[model samples]
Target: MMKLASLGLFVFDASTFPFSDLNRRRDWRYGAAPRIGDRDATQYLGPGDELVTLTGALVPEAGARYGSIKTLATMADQGEAYPFVDGSGVVWGSFIILSMDERRRALLVDGTPRMIDFTVELRRVA
Candidate 1:
């Protein structure tokens, strides 16, 4: 929903709507061995990892929101990380941009991006 830029200089509001395929996957690592005549034995390791991925697009709100998404997409392309906060003010931690896609018809006649469809894979970094 919103992100605080570094140094608190400004905030980039990238509000997205019609969020699709939003999900979270949590996993753990373990060691398992099969027994000869029985089932199997498992050993617990430790905490594994978590990641959240989703596909969504920016609505045609106004200029500033659209402009900020362009900036974020550029930063995402360079493997930059940012705190992805939702409209509920929940901080999703540092997330690296895995992928971004834009529809060709999303651009306005003035050359500004009106709507952007993107799919991003966000890994949670403690």
Candidate 2:
């Protein structure tokens, strides 16, 4: 269970385990695919620039609890380094928030925030 600095990005979904997808994929695949299983070349061994991509979701209604989602969702203006820590308090990496999903929106009766869910894509800083 890694935590991002975004606040409540995890833990909002009582039915889902937020940090379940804390994993990285390091590979470079460049080829021309004429068919689904056909590749002209399959040689991809890159250091990935010593960076790992971390993907997680802010709980639905994250904005309501954490304030306006715009605070973090405004990616073009909020390109900053955020700390990424694992459940054991290990500094895994500094992640850069790539983009913000509008956090799925909905029209409700109680007038809760429209944004219910948002996903974050980040690259680990080396």
Best by lDDT: 1
Q: Ten-residue segment with the worst summed lDDT in candidate 1?
A: 4-13
Candidate 1 structure quality by residue, lDDT tens digits, 1-126? 444222112243444234446677878889899999997899999757777666666666643344545665667667656676654666666667665555534667887766666665666665
| Top model number, TM-score | 1
Every candidate's lDDT:
0.59, 0.47
What's the lDDT for residue 29 in model 1? 85
Off by over 4 Å in 2: 1-23, 28-46, 49-68, 74-76, 109-111
Clashes of 1: 0
Span of ten consecutive residues with least summed lDDT in model 2: 5-14
List candidate 1 segments past 4 Å from native: 1-21, 61-64, 77-93, 106-114
